[model samples]
Target: MSNMQHELQHLPASAGLEARTVGRVGIVGASSTGIGIAIQLLDAGVPVTFYEADAAALGAGLAQIRSAWTDTHDSRLALLAGTINFHHLKDADLVVDASETEGGEALFRRLDQTTKPGAILATAAAGAGVDRLAGATRRHGEVLGLRVDRAQVWELVPGRDTSDPTLATVGALARRLHAPAAARR
Candidate 1:
């Protein structure tokens, strides 16, 4: 099995999240992390929109997803979309920054400005701390770090200013996505 599939299989159980906790999800970048996350969320019937400045990269990423999808291609594709416009993320309830490039503060600041208030912003950048990312955003309470390790464990790191509600929401989301081992830090 693929590494992504292996990781998905080992996630922990539910965190008592509502069925409709996540209305929509926005992903920045077309990296492997972003595509893996999209697969998991789409399988749970959540709509996912991918934003990439490079149209070619976006297309490649979409193609990669299609190729990796072994079943339920039509339904998953129905819930997937790709865009070059960053503003389109305004409607996302959860925005994950999985860009391979090191955008740092500029990226988080822009994401904070573009997304609607109350939206949760997460990073798939493994070594990037939640506090650093949150420091760049106005929605400090809504910023966190989410990363899946090689062993299939998920780490949900909250910043100092991260609100309890945000942590709960993300925990619920992790459950909905079948990531049972999501531990908060």
Candidate 2:
């Protein structure tokens, strides 16, 4: 199994978040973290819009998400069924890229062009750093990085330009999802 899959398997039960605070979220890639995070949010009543370039990957992701949720809250499957290919995230309060690919940086570049003005752009960039991702966009203050490991901890790594609001927003999201985030670094 992939390293990401291992983390997903151990994902803690949800504390759920305020739907209004989260509003809408857009997630890129059908990766383990992306799918797992989506399931967590949907179960908590947050509306999520998923974007994927490939149809097959999206299908596999949706299937995995459905299986994970259907056993508990079958109704959530309907909410997770929505998937779009185009970058129509103008409404997403947070656009997170959970993909662990080397192409992750490139996706960040595209997000700048597509995401709306104040929306936060988050990536699971591991140790690659979020500078490059933050630099690609005009709203550098909102770019952040997430690091999740098999040890069952999450680290919210902020870039030089990341603003306090961005940090606070992600920190709240992490808490709501029951994923404790490490101290800002």
Candidate 3:
């Protein structure tokens, strides 16, 4: 097998971070950050639903994802990557808020109501107030905030009630994308 395939097959599994546990995921935005997160999850055999308000933006974002793939990457991306609406998000186990901090609170509140119980809500907003966002939801215990710039260090700031399981889940996902990305503070 090629090195990339070998590496993926040999990825050291973190205890309690069961790949199956993190089921279907829904990402709020369809930009580079959102697509990057989807890639990370889809590469691990996780299903993803990309949510973009603008149909043109969704088409563009999907094109970007398709362009990034090579013959070597998993073929399942073709099936794993797709679009969905807010009503379809109730089945998602994790909902990532990849939008910039422009009216993010309202979005978070909406997600809180739409997502099923125990589903984690993650924000890709850089240095944003995750605690305040979580305050808008009753599932504050399932909220986590982290950012990835592909250029700088990041902080995995847990909200006021973010549970250990939620932190571990996001931490495992972060490690998969960039190992040793310590969740400082």
Candidate 4:
């Protein structure tokens, strides 16, 4: 398995984030972390749209998302069933890219063009150059990086161009996820 998958496999059951009301979320890359986030968001009542360049990869991600909820004895499959779309991504309230794949970059670019100006765009790239990505996109101020690990919850990694409003929004989302609020300086 990939490092991303291995990392997600060891995530603590209570990473401090409880799924709250996520309205609409778009995930790119469909890696282990990507699929995990999609499932968690959907279980929390958010509708999710996933974008994958490979049909088989998309299918696998859908299956993974379903399996996570299924094995947990959560019977929200009916609600979560139709809540997931395995096709082209549409405008969503929030968008998360699990890796620094080209597909993720493309989706970020597209979202930069079409999504509402205030939409949240987060990346799960721990070491990727977030500043460069933000620079290449249209919504520089709204972009942020998220780092997650087994022992802790989401950590916001600020991009060079990130703004205060973006940080505030990230805090709100983290709260909604039941994750600890980002430490304020």
TM-score of each: 0.84, 0.79, 0.78, 0.72
Residue 104 in candidate 1, Cα distance off native in Å: 1.3
**lDDT of candidate 2?**
0.70
Clashes of each: 4, 0, 0, 0
Q: Candidate 1 versus the native: TM-score?
A: 0.84
Residue pairs with backbone overlap in model 2 = none
Ten-residue segment with the worst summed lDDT in candidate 3? 6-15
lDDT of 4 by residue, 76-142 (tens): 4543432234333445767778744644566567668766656778888667667777876888877
In order, candidate lDDTs are 0.79, 0.70, 0.70, 0.63
Top-down TM-score ranking: 1, 2, 3, 4
User: What C-alpha lDDT, on a 0 to 100 scale, does residue 181 get in candidate 4?
Assistant: 39
Q: Which candidate is the best by TM-score?
A: 1
For residues 92-126, write the lDDT of model 2, one tens digit per residue: 88887876575555677777777777788888755
Cα shift from native, residue 39, model 1 (Å): 0.7
Pick by lDDT: 3 or 4, better one: 3
Best by lDDT: 1
TM-score of 4: 0.72
Which segments of model 4 are wrong by more than 4 Å?
Answer: 1-22, 71-88, 100-107, 181-185
**Candidate 4 global Cα RMSD:** 7.9
- In model 1, residue pairs whose N, Cα or C atoms come closer than 3 Å (at least 3 residues apart or on different chains), thus clashing, are 11-180, 12-180, 12-181, 13-180
RMSD of each: 4.6, 6.9, 5.5, 7.9
Q: How accurate is candidate 1 locally (lDDT)?
A: 0.79
**Over 4 Å off in model 3, which ranges?**
1-20, 71-74, 151-155, 175-178
